[model samples]
Target chain A: MTMTATTDRTLPDPADRRAAAHAFIAGQARWRWPEAVFWLVAAASLVIFPHSLVLAAQVLIAGLFALSLDLILGLGGIVSLGHAAFFGLGAYTAGLLAAHGWNEPLTGLVAAGLVAGLVGFATSFIVVRLKGIALLMVTMGVALLLHEVAQKAHAITGGDDGLQGISMAPILGLFSFDLYGRTAFIYTLAVVFACFLVARRLYNSPFGLALKGMRENGRRVPAIGGSIRRHSALIYTIAAVMAGIAGGLLAQTTEFVSVEVLGFQRSAEVLIMLVLGGAGLLYGGFVGAAVFLVARQILSGIDQTYWFFWLGLMLVLVVLFARNGLLGGAKALLARWRRA
Target chain B: MLLSLANILFNGVAYGMLLFLIAVGLSVTMGLMGFANLAHGAFAMLGGYVTATLMAKAGWPFFATLPAAFVLVALASLVLERALYRRLYRAGELDQVLLTIGVVFMAVAGATFVWGPSQAPIRVPAYLTGTVAIGPFDWGVYRLFLIAMGALVTLALIVGLERTRFGAMIRAAVDNPRMATGLGINVDRVFSITFMLGSGLAGLGGALGVNLIGLDPSFPIKYLVYFLIVVAVGGLGSIKGSLIAAIVLGVCDVAGKYYLPDTGAFIIYVIMVSLLLWRPLGLFGRR
Candidate 1:
């Protein structure tokens, strides 16, 4: 009996080892100093710029969109060019809901998430099977189709006049959406923060590690007893939900939804934002959205027609020189500083 | 009803030929060279603009401007390949996409700056203006010209690729670049020439298609999807596949527009998605 017990102790169960590793990784990811500092700085920005609440709200929505993209592209290694499908779906759902008198914010957001998640779930089966350029084409096709549908469905979508007269109610029977966007900013921030926490939890989970493994080497996933299709579909659905929430937030704050919400340009712009911030890192979305949105606002003010020229040039330079994006560049610099 | 069907078939074939002309070069670059060039539509736009400018401003005949468009676009592509695209041969698909997208934006913006934000109108020669009566069907003379041009180019391409020494060299280089290099074939030069050839064809297509598709600052963005669809559905690197796919797409698009006027451009995408789902590697694409 003692010999058998010794042998069992010698060869620990694989499941136990996995659990221990997961716990260790989860511990490591819990409330890092950098994350704390990042959130602190973000909070401080709201305090410092009291008047720029609308812009702040817009940035938060953009950041949320970027984050949703990051979950699929960065972590799951699914490069989608049509993520605006979910965002638009969410926006339209919330916009329609408000326009038709279901003006509650939280319920509308949840409905948006569910609608987008349903769409994502339905599409993921077909989409997850594709890789590389084929995947890109399919995603693009979906977005283009949605855009055309939205454009042509004039009776319901308002046909380029945009879905208007969407009046959202106060947050939790208080904090009405003021013209100054004070309530909008705080509500957006809170939603983003809540979504960020969920994403963070997912990132440190066993499923996230599995996704990481697949990203590194897709072939090895099955050998280790993981289903790429199942995992991809799950992540895609979750990402869609997150994107839906972002879109709903935008609609609620702005009280409008345009066909532009479903445009290919929006998809491309979100991709550019994610790439600019640095993919693979959780905070990269926030950083990228802030920089891209702010830069666009400034550049458009300077020369509305010629702003894309500068934006295009920046994208080219970034892809050529800074493949890892702004955050990656910063990380590299910090590492160098520490080494020195 | 029969006459409308005939007209649709004829128009579809003409449009398909135009798409083939634009997409063939893109397929060669994407499939043969392994480069994801989203700026290819820009080259086609350049060709159209060149043709339009010469015809409208210089009083050049429409037919005479086609070759000029081809040559100019070819030369431009050659210069760009040497200066920029050559360096990105080994870059990831994401980088390639971003770089090409940037080029597209720049091209669009530059075109807008140079030629004001208006569609460039084309004046077809008088002989090519009217329709021809054939067994109770009216076929546009300009469309006949396009069909003829497409056939000639397809014939030349097939003969050149299959029955010539230069064609063998290209095939060899594409199949095994390392082996071709070992055999002392200047693979780089072969690629450059091929790239130029592809760009030239796109230019020719653009020059020919300007009247049919319209030309404007947003030309690249507008037609990029169509070209990409042709290349993708044709099963990249296959000329015959592109030809077949383009024809099918053209027919479907015309039919969809005629039947379902409400959906506008949605049907083609639906077709693309369904087809892609059925065959992920494209209809004729290799595993």
Candidate 2:
């Protein structure tokens, strides 16, 4: 045992291991064929599904929101039930800006992201310190607080009446939000694509790898010179920004913002979307959002009244048997097939 | 001024008692069992509906339905714990949360369909109608009755959990299930019983709260934050902590509503977040 241990001490030199890690990171950072196909299909849907642009735009928004949630949940191992706090903030930010004459779509998104990130940073002190259910409650509390505030602030939010009569200028002073839903779909798709690109790049970076280590064993990460608070705060803020932009997209695309944008149901819906897609994987949010929205559309079309029951049943079925969600199930099947 | 203040205090304490009644079970389920049962408020909603149905449709007195609600909801919870919740005890935290959330959704949908999404009204019995003299001032008999019931329940829980052999088994099981199992304790049975008790109390609390808080389809979602606040602030598994936290939050809620209606509801959420920040494990949590 002693001789074997001594031999291991000098094996697989540190430099070689470092080089291997870089190669692995580079390989992961490179876009895979599946991602290329996914985006291509998404962009192509603009023409393929000409009549479904509105729903398509909505899917993109939910996808972006779910993607933001995925960052903290799948990557940082932070679980929350109130991620709508940032989304709501973003929506309101863009809505209020449009209401107050700053209707430039892209800039509105930036402002939404900044506001959401600031709120996230402010809350990070509390968020970073918690784990499991406690974290869920705190995050929920923040969202509920925001929801309550939104409901009560009648002058600013228009209370239950919602923020109405707000309009945004055309994208880049050229493409106006048309009645045919083309501009909104393209705008949302472009924004979602941009955010996804940044998120995808970050997912395989050295910092992202360190985050995975933190998620696996937080105590060990601290021992290895990682500041858990700093990493969590940064990722949490980035996710919040992404969520905010999604919210901003909704406000800009729809030309309205309602108090329900900040509701607990919205938060829960996005969580379901993320879970349905599968967490951690970058494409999981997009896939989950697509399935959830399309399923919701079909269900609501059939029975508008009892749709919540169907949703509940779906979530229950998902949690019970498909804990890792559809993508995970497919991957598991793939692994078994390979083994066979 | 003194009398109104006294009235607010009385109402606030009564509210706090009701909150404690609902949240104490969650304190155990989440704090002791380490399961995030977000649907806890659903059990409370079920209790409220049972009471409403018994009093309104079945011509039962308001007081008579409380026990029925407790018994019925306890039975329902037993079925749920056995078939659904039991499967996820050893599962991931998120799965447990999602499952319970799913349960909440189903319960909400069921209630909405059965009860038509309207508030279920329970008649305030003649016995609890008017104010009675206490010291120099008259206080509402209903509020006084709520306080008395809350105190009785608290005492019973403390004695039952601390003085009984079953309670010892529960503590052992919660602290270390492996060791408790090794020592011949039936951990599963203990957990089921504990869950039943927790859910039963929730039902009773819900039944009792109908007059003050009202019973509705949205009850579970609406008061979820408050129940969670009580459990989190009080510290998981600490009955004493929950009672204190409930009373503190109840008073704050009541006072805030009365004093500053515009921002009163926001205060509790802020307080919960701030307290959790200071005591992440909770004010009295051991873990």
Candidate 3:
């Protein structure tokens, strides 16, 4: 009698829960109009702003880099100070490939992603255990170590002078890179869009929800049958692969790689971009990259020597006034306006 | 071979002392207060610039510049603490990091504007220059001075923190802020003073460093990793741990470079990872 009663009550719960989960995932994955607008704007930029394709290509690369960071930062709530380690590795991977005569662009990217992913998998074990200041220092230490290694292996990495004479094969043997940057822009946009699709899908999945659950409450995640370390480490490695591809894109587009690619400043700059655009939001990376690149271009134009002053001021003001960053703040305002 | 080993040992100790001096203050604030104050390096940079400007522009001797660096950076820290950092004491880690990074950027630009982008040269008095013969080996006079200064500062800090009534109050506040307040201690004032004191020490370290590391706009970022490493390995809020940690790291780093020649930089980082994995709280940190 007791077993029958328990079965009657609990049987519907699992089915109901599963259905609810499916509905939630579907709702999140459902195509939003703004996402369409976003792609439309990107496509139109190729035509509307053809002269600025080079900058647009750079912007897309930065966006992709930031997006990769968001995978860990937004979902896992893991703050990494050494993301540039992967970026630089990817760049070097692509650079070396081209330098050694395997200049095919598409294959070069795959190799870059694989190499970075391998390193990420190795380091993720160490990264997943630490938190707060310890996490920050360790990540910084890892990057600095890589930076040191690269400098010492100058014979292979070009040392202080940076790798020279890197050129890439045309896209699918059809579109060659031109000085006007049309090929670069289209190529970069296509790659970033594909990555975005993956990120969007992953963010709406049950696995991503589990990672988010751990971020909200680590203890609760365990109770819900999730392994905190495994989720964190896997997400970290995935992000590293994405970051690697971004770096590869940069190397291919620029046709060069410098020792500065793996620098502490580069890591800090990317983190700043992510936070400035409101980290944790899927589209925040794109907005942050656009703002940062534009700001960099405009500020440098105003005065090369003191542009940093204005950027610093902007950062301070943003932190003080808008704690959640530009996108978060804007969304809050929209919410408030609608209620009123 | 023996002479070279000794030489390496001496150089390593000197470098380690400099690292200790630069990081000890950060160790205290970060360890005890639980603040991620990365801009501590900026204060150190300010101190270096101050020393450089005084020596270059006004022709002050090295000794005179040191005190000025300490007092000035301390005052500047006080201003920043009161106006900016005070608001973020309870904020998230990201807020603290971004705010400090902003400060570093501003400081770098400010230094560049005032001092230009070149490395600022420092001239130590002749007495602090040249080598002195000690037991069949010539030891660098400047390096010997650095060791002496490092030891003196350590002794002073140890005595000040362990013996003084102010130290007790500071310790109490860090241990239990609410309880310290209930005990009639002004916790705010204590933290402010401690923070200023830490900044002043960093400034002193920076002024002292000018002769060794040289002063530049990139000073903060250039040595940021080394400082952070010392604190991380040393354990927060423990002077003895920092001393031991700094000495070990300094020796390893210098010796690795000397022997390995090519892959010298790899050793210290390896040591750090191994140590932290074994003991995440560092050499003396509490849970």
Interface CA RMSD, all predictions? 1.0, 1.2, 1.5
lDDT for each residue of candidate 3 in B171-222, tens digit (9 for 90 to 100): 8988899999999999999999999988998999999988887889988877
Q: Which ten residues in a row have the lowest lDDT in candidate 2 chain A?
A: A303-312
When only the first chain is scored, the TM-scores of the models are: 0.95, 0.95, 0.96
Error of 1 at A311 (Å): 1.5
Q: Which candidate is the best by DockQ?
A: 1
Tell me, by lDDT, which candidate is best.
Answer: 2
Q: Encode model 1's per-residue lDDT on A1-340: one tens digit a residue.
A: 9998998898788998888897899785779688889877777667888887788789889999999999999999888889999999999999999999999999999999999999999999988999867888999999899999999988888868999789988889887998888888889988999999999888888889899999999999999999999999999999999999999999999999999998888998898888988998988888889998899889989876587787788788888788888999999999999999
Model 3 chain A — which ten-residue stretch has the worst lDDT?
A: A304-313
TM-score of 1: 0.96
The global C-alpha lDDT for each of the candidates, from Candidate 1 onward, is 0.90, 0.90, 0.89
**DockQ for every prediction shown:** 0.75, 0.72, 0.66
TM-score of chain B of 1: 0.98
TM-score of chain A as modeled in candidate 2: 0.95
In model 2, residue pairs whose N, Cα or C atoms come closer than 3 Å (at least 3 residues apart or on different chains), thus clashing, are none
The TM-score, computed over Cα atoms with residue i paired to residue i, of candidate 3 is 0.96
For model 3, the superposed segments whose C-alpha errors exceed 4 Å read A1-12
